[model samples]
Target: MKLRTLLAVFGVALALTGFTLVAAPGLASTITLDEAVLVFVGLLGVLQGVRVAIARSRTAYEQVETPDPEASQDLPTPGDEFDEMLATAGADRREREMRESVRNRLERAAVATIVRTEGCTEAEAKRRLESGEWTDDPYARAFFTGSVEGASLFDRIDLRRDNQSRYHRWAVHAASEITRRSEGFDA
Candidate 1:
């Protein structure tokens, strides 16, 4: 039965029992069977409501209100050691090779970005890129067609004003270079 209905029934039974006990002098002196049952049922309804309230309280407490300790501790920040690794890798590579690799990575990053934004899989994004379906897409056109000249493809893609933003620009530039090289353009 619904909680409200059960509560209403319990209240009515209790009220009737109380009225009966008050009217009868003999019943007022001693607890009757009907009065006992009504009290028990009312207590049970109250207990049920308390139980539901407690359960709901616990569920609310366990919800995503607090930040996860592991998540907060483990996730890399903008100025983390990972940035050093990327810088070292870039520095280690010859200028020509580095440029090509960066271009390839950027292209892949662009595809990944589109896939994430469009809610598509990596495979779908790759197909779109390979098939030239992204020629009309503003992001794709900007990255691929060299539409925005002088600013390096990286700069265009790194719209965010942060450390990772610089990395994004570099990635785009690298990917563009890789694409050009693959198409037999001089490095």
Candidate 2:
């Protein structure tokens, strides 16, 4: 049974017992067990009702009000939000890959240029690039002087406005040299 119903029944029983005791005063003194049991039951019912009331009030206060359905319509659905996040991440990955590709192409061209002009091995050219050491040759110096650590390809280009054109020229030159070597041609 519900707490309210149980408490109400106990209250009614207590009132009947009190009435019975008042109607028979002589018997009430003789019935010590019945009086004590009724008093205990009454106190228990009152305490339990108070506890139930407090619990109900606390839950009511803790309950959250529902947001208006019209207001919620303005919010993006989970799927739409997920798609937006995925698109942003994909774009970021593509941009990073592009930057890395440009950086690699610049390095390869610089390495190939050094090997062709200075008569050095590719490994030695790469080491020279890393060491920031340049030869007297203008072409080699052009590649070497443009080097900057941790800078993006565009940032490097911005540092020297001509570096962008230089990078393109060097990249073409590197590709041609690779093709020539692969084809077993001295040129």
Candidate 3:
């Protein structure tokens, strides 16, 4: 027999032996061997039925339970396509916004140098603006910060180059300016 079946049989035998031992000595009740066997089988059947019923009830209760969507939806579901799509879209939107913000900042920086050279071509002025040489230039940080407007040096470079160069140059210039200002130096 399988281990579980053997265990069940042993359990029943132990239960019958315990009951016989506990019976009162004055009560001379005679149960036939067949009747004792039948009673043990009946008890085993009842125990098995009770176990199955308890298991079925537990399964039914779990199946009927519904979780609140608001509480559960925030967590990522494993292997769920819709959840993955939403997460990807959110990431893409954030990246695009960051790129746009950088472009706007560069444009602002380019517009600030207009006053110094009235007739200067936008291309030449942008080159001058992006070159690392002008990082100390007073208008550089203001350009990125959106404080300066109208014909800044950034307008001189071609729009594409202007964006690339301005992003790099402005970042450096802005950092330096921040450090300078922090130390109470005017930049």
Query: Where is model 1 more than 4 Å wrong at Cα?
Result: 1-94, 127-140, 147-187
Task: Return the clash pairs for model 3, or none.
Answer: 110-152, 110-154, 111-152, 112-152, 113-152, 114-151, 122-156, 123-156, 126-156, 126-157
1 versus 3: better lDDT goes to: 1
Q: Go through the candidates in order and give each one's C-alpha lDDT.
A: 0.58, 0.58, 0.50
Instruction: Write candidate 3's Cα lDDT for 10-109 as tens digits.
Output: 6887777768757854332566668868977987787677667766777744346677676545865653552343334334545555545554544444
Which candidate number has the best lDDT?
2
User: Candidate 1 lDDT, tens digit per residue, 1-187?
Assistant: 4567667877897798679877897977787679877978778877788767766777744445776576445677753453444465455544556445544655676576556555678888777666545444333444444444345666555665554434344444444544443454232
User: Whole-model lDDT for model 3 versus the true structure?
Assistant: 0.50
* CA deviation > 4 Å runs, candidate 2: 1-94, 135-187
TM-score of each: 0.26, 0.26, 0.23
> Candidate 1 vs candidate 3: which has greater TM-score?
1
